[model samples]
Target: MAKITKKEVEHVSRLARLELSDEEKETFTKQLNNILTYVEKLNELDTKDVEPTSHVLQIQNIFKEDEIRESLPRERALSNAPDRTDEFYRVPKIIE
Candidate 1:
C-alpha cells in the first residue's frame, strides 16, 4: 500500500471540517499509514472456509409465558394521582 501523505491527511481534515495543526497532520499521516498496514496484514489471512457473521455469539430472547391476571379498577389506579378526571389523569400542558 502507498504511504499516507501529509497532503492526504490535510485534505481529509478539511473535508471533515477539522482544523489540524502541522504536527497533528504529520501524526495522523503516520497513524493512518499504520492502520492501512494492519488492514493489509489482515487481508493475508485464510478466510475462504469461514462464514461471514454479524456477531461472534448467538443471541436469543428469553421470556416467561404470558398469562391472564386480575387488574386494579380505574378509581383504584388513579387514587395516588394529584389530579384526575372520571377516566384519565390530568397533567400540565407541555406543548403549544
Candidate 2:
C-alpha cells in the first residue's frame, strides 16, 4: 500500500498556498511515499539495549575564567567619533 496519496498531496499543497500541476502532484505523492517507506524501515531496528544520546560525540566547555578589568577612559573612547557632546556621543534623531 502507498504511504501517501495524491489527494493528501493536493491538500498539503493547498495548505501551503502552492499551485501544483497534476504531473507535479503525482510526482510528489510517489516521492513522499518513498520517503515514508524508507523511514518505516527504521522500526525494524533492534534498539532495546541502545542508550539514547543528544549527540554522537562527547562535548565539553572550553572557556577562560571571567574577571573584573579596567574600562577605557571616556575621552579616549570618543576620540575617533564623528560627533560628540561634552559627555556623550551625539547621534541623529530617529523617532518622531
Best by TM-score: 2
lDDT (0 to 1) per candidate: 0.87, 0.92
| Clash list (residue pairs), candidate 1 | none
Kindly report which residue stretches of model 2 are placed more than 4 angstroms away from their true locations once superposed.
Answer: 45-96
Instruction: Give lDDT for model 2.
Output: 0.92
TM-score of each: 0.44, 0.45
Q: How big is the RMSD of model 2?
A: 11.0
Q: How does residue 57 of candidate 2 score in lDDT?
A: 77
Candidate 1 accuracy as TM-score: 0.44
lDDT digits (tens) for residues 1-96 of candidate 2 = 998899999999999999999999999999999999999988899999989998877988678679877889989999999999897899999798
Give all candidate RMSDs, comma-separated. Answer: 11.4, 11.0
- Deviation of model 2 at 73, angstroms: 31
